[model samples]
Target: MEKLEEQIAHLTRTVEDLSDVVARQDQEIALLTRRVALLLEREASREAEGTGGVVLGDERPPHY
Candidate 1:
């Protein structure tokens, strides 16, 4: 029937749209995962080098 066909078409379009959204989200997640890994590596290296000290409140600057 025409009504059934119309419903099928609508559903198919909705599914395709959802698929696109999911693909985009997958790419974004992958990029963020890579960035997090890089940052972790950098932090680890900094720790190993014994640099990157944390300054507390009321502490004088190292340049002082």
Candidate 2:
């Protein structure tokens, strides 16, 4: 029937739109995941090198 065909077409378009949205979100999540991994690696390296320090409210900078 024509109505059934219209319904199918509408559903197909909706699915395609959702798929595009999911693909974009997947890419964004992947990028954020990589950034987090890099930051964690850098933090681990700094800690391992024994150069990690704390910042106090009222203290001289580390370079002082």
Candidate 3:
């Protein structure tokens, strides 16, 4: 009976640890989803303004 109790305790602890890991991952995924949505909105607004081309560092403008 004592051996059975020990096994049950270990299994419970393992399950709790896994639950914590899953909760943390869920929060991270939610944050990333929000950031992606914001970026898409910003890109859409830029396109609407007719500035679709992005100028990189030391890059010449299209008119140059």
Best candidate according to lDDT: 1
Local distance difference test values of all predictions, in order: 0.96, 0.95, 0.96
Q: How far is candidate 1 from the true structure (C-alpha RMSD, Å)?
A: 1.9
Off by over 4 Å in 3: 55-60
Kindly provide the TM-score of model 2 when superposed on the true structure, using C-alpha atoms.
0.78
Q: Alpha-carbon error at 47 in model 3, in Å?
A: 0.9
On the 0 to 100 scale, the lDDT of residue 59 in model 1 is 100
lDDT of 2: 0.95
Candidate 3 lDDT tens digits, 1-64: 9999999999999999999999999999999999999999999998999887878999988788
Sort order, TM-score high to low: 1, 3, 2
Check candidate 1 and list the clashing pairs: none
* Better candidate by TM-score, 1 or 3: 1
Deviation in Å, model 2, residue 45 alpha carbon = 1.0
**TM-score for each predicted model, relative to the true structure:** 0.84, 0.78, 0.81
Colliding residue pairs in candidate 3: none
